[model samples]
Target: MPEMLMEVEEEDDVVPNGRVLITGATGLLGRAVYKEFKDNNWHVLGTSYSRLRPRLEILNLLDSSAVNGLVQDFKPHVIVHCAAERRPDIVENQPDSAAMLNVGASENLAKVAAAVGAFLIYISSDYVFDGTNPPYKTDSVPNPLNLYGKTKLEGERVVLQNNDGAAVLRVPVLYGDVEKIEESAVTIMFDKVQHSNKSANMDHWQQRFPTYVKDVASVCLQMAEKKLQDPSLKGIFHWSGNEQMTKYEIACAMADAFNLPCSHLRPITDEPVGATPRPWNPQLDCSRLEALGIGQRTPFRAGIRESLWPFLVEKKWQQTIFH
Candidate 1:
């Protein structure tokens, strides 16, 4: 816990904004956003589904009264909507939960945020598009392929309709700052490659463009900052890492980064079998984000090097001490 707290807090930081309300406060990106807002001295209130810690206050987003009352009392200037049933498999199995949490809760938040005259920012996904296209723009029509994507798209619509100043940020698969490497799929591939003795069959069919959590959080904050002046900076915007690689290629890159043996990693050129459909080419064009001068610039290799740091060092230390 001390280490987790320490992982945050860079020497340089931004000045505080007004109050902020963040849902899914304990999630991967949620936690990062919370820490970022707090570090910058913003009055930050975060909500979680489960009782996680002192910082995260558990609240049932389905309970419209609870959500409305929370916003009314907190009176946040900005609301970062991060809570949702994001996993495709979980959403597929529990469609009810997905609809309630993703779509319904989003509508509730947007209504409250609008009533309170607060700027809303909804975190959306790349899966909103079917894999038939190579790159999607902000104005691209969403043709969701799974229940999760459907709910997110619906959530986006409700949010934008409710609050004209609300921003919908569509991001690709995000990875970074994990307690365990397996917490992120990208890092999980790296972990598997590092620990496993035998070669692995790496998927090479679908194209993936993974963004770092910090980058996404940064963009969210920048948009929020812009809202302070230009309240009209609202609409669908996309942010992604500049890198485009297949899973196999990413695994190979990870192998090279960690000095692991790549001979064991065999490229399997086939689509992955799953209960949910995956977008083959989820390459999003960030021209909109770039036009606004808020584009993400973290190169994939540099981002990985930053992410792998203390964790990799700590792992090697544990290995030495235990062995």
Candidate 2:
């Protein structure tokens, strides 16, 4: 924990439009969410467990007392739950640990937020739906193919059950300004594209809408603001990038957009063999959130370029080509 967080400022001492608590504040999506809320002049206090930072409150969500104490002390008006065991393969390998965070921790956070009379927004995934269907709606039945999706779906259920005014924002694969290329599932492919001499096989069987984290974070801010004005803005909602592409297509776009090499990349047209099963094309129907006038979708090419440019420049890997 940082010494700044130990100072313990009284909730009433600060006056802002609203106060928001973001979990997993050091992760990809959480960082964006923290920035979005803070830029909007909201009183934002982000939490981190493993990746501790100066501003973030080091919190272990699995600890019930710590969770309650933080929420009670902060007294935030909104809580954005972004922390979870998100990796599908890893979740499959450790279902029990995943459940403790994705399911157990989520339920606890939702309950705590409700007890504090705060509006909670639970970040969910499109993987909750099986790929047999196209564009699943907010109310669509979830048939997760693997343990990760199932755990997220269960988290959604517990959150909604615990708080009537809580919302579940289901999004698809995400990419953003990453601390490392491997931080994002989408940008993780850059390794293959960057290694000009190394041949790699990319998955082209499944369709994915790679959404931007900054856009999702903006939507979360909008939802929080709207919820404050209208308390009835609750329930499951979907927000995803409209541009559809596969991993192979994404790598191709990265090469084109960033002037990276792709000759060594091979596209696998069939479902790629993996330890975990993923949906073929579980595109989310974002109309529910769009209807409420809350959403943003960045084009894939432009978004990826913006996300990776800084990292590329920092590594001095094709600095001349970028400018």
Candidate 3:
């Protein structure tokens, strides 16, 4: 587990370059964001409801009082809000919980962060846009197709409206350094493909840009640094990987990475039936961040390979009958 610094000692005289408070610090993207700020010599504190540890502070963003108390005590210069219900399918089934986390908690956090004069960065998703468009920009209109996207879009609005200095960063599908394969939509493909004896149907229709979590974390750090230097950095931004791939393509890549046979994997050429309604090819136009030199796109092949290699070794699935 990566080290997430706890509350600073009251007597510590040395002032750090900046202080950052990261919500959902135990999650995939949150973990990366926490590490990025800490590595750059910032006084960083992370919060999580579950996955609690010795150094992390237990925070439930939904509780207005708890949220307010923590932000006031930490007095961070920036608040990176990464906690939310990101799974679309899960959101569809659990609308109430999704709204509470994605909407209510975000709104509360925005209000609290504003009271402390902290710069807020709310992590959003590309699902805000409908699938009919390609290469969506920051100004693109949002028409979320499912409950998850809808709630996230609502979260963006509340955060920006509540906090004048809030910035909404919309990213595409993400995968990196997960504690479990099922933790990420991208990494889970390996699990599906490993069942080589059974036939698996993978979606090859809706195009997706599988962004890396580490890269997103780097961008968050850069944005926070720049925002401190220039307060005008608040607004909407887009950061995504350039490589375009479908689920079938991603599964095939994972199989190739581990030299596993994927003959039983079949590609579904049409929209996935009866599942969550996801946008097709809602590719984000990342020129805004690129122009400012504020992003990075790791090649899909290399990135996914690195992410899944450890799991392969751990599971002892590296050896095959033929090899």
Candidate 4:
């Protein structure tokens, strides 16, 4: 099957002169970031640990020497660290691996960033919160409940401690059409509905702040460029869509937008019925990103509509669902 072409908004800004290094370029979010910078005509260098077919520099982030070598070679002015073990359940099961990738690799990247004097933008998660608050602010103290969140939070600390000029943007659920479906809840749900006639039975009780992948990447690139030009604009910022939505709401919205049946939905609680601890609420207040001139352009429904088109045409929806 031919790869689905992505529809991105054209921006007139020329890619800056300095090189930009993006880790995890194979992943959905990372790939979006790569496209954003590449479109601007910036000299883009990317890294991938497993999927090397996409033309990214093959490098394991855990390899400190290799990371150092890449830094020396590329000499990027901006380093967007998007690589991490992001599976919450898997991270809880295997913390050591998660720690190695999320915490240790991040520290290594920070060291390289400091050595090369590069502006580092680390992608963080709203899961850093313990779900006690409704809308988390950038200044909110993080109390992670799961290993994945803990690891990412540690990564955030590593970037901040290592480089005072670094910017850490904490985002929530990211929804978009991408090659991989493993890490995207929105894609997973949409696939289930489109192929298996199964719908996500999300608890209307649990709510979250979701951002479009393209929007998130755009914000990250803008922030990185701004930070490169002005050293004083360095700190942690919260980046999320403007609204708070439950999983059920999102699923229904997808179904409605795509003309899919929504009857398969089953209501489940925010808490795990048998095992695992689920963060009931992971909503973030993105006023900080807004103030920095980075915010959501399309509404949730419109974004979902745009994302669903590729799935409908590619007929790959069935491939995305399990059972």
Q: Pick the candidate with the highest lDDT.
A: 2
Cα TM-score per model = 0.89, 0.92, 0.92, 0.88
Candidate 3 C-alpha lDDT tens digits along 17-106:
788999999999999999998888899999999789768999888889999999999999999999999999889999999999999999
Ranking by lDDT: 2, 3, 1, 4
Top-down TM-score ranking: 2, 3, 1, 4
Could you give me the TM-score of model 4 versus the true structure?
0.88
**Lowest lDDT block of 10, candidate 3:** 1-10
Between candidates 1 and 2, which one is better according to lDDT? 2
- Can you tell me which runs of candidate 4 are displaced by over 4 Å? 1-16, 195-200, 313-323
Write down the TM-score for model 1.
Answer: 0.89
Q: Judged by TM-score relative to the true structure, which candidate is superior, 1 or 3? A: 3
CA RMSD per model (angstroms): 6.8, 5.7, 5.5, 7.9
Best by TM-score: 2
| Tens digits of per-residue lDDT for model 1, 1-323 | 88766556542244356899999888778888888778778889999986477867778999999888888999999999888888888899999978999999999899999999999999999999997886899988889988889999999999988888899999888787776776676877875567557878888888998788888888888888888988779899998887888888887877677666788888888787854788888778889878888855677877776777655634666568977
Return model 3's CA RMSD, one decimal. 5.5
Q: What total of clashing residue pairs does each candidate reach?
A: 1, 0, 0, 2
Q: How do the residues 157-220 of candidate 4 rate in per-residue lDDT, one tens digit apiece?
A: 9889988788888888888766655458766677655553544566676676667889988887
lDDT of each: 0.84, 0.92, 0.89, 0.81
lDDT value, residue 220 of candidate 2: 97
Q: Among all windows of ten consecutive residues in candidate 2, which has the lowest summed lDDT?
A: 6-15
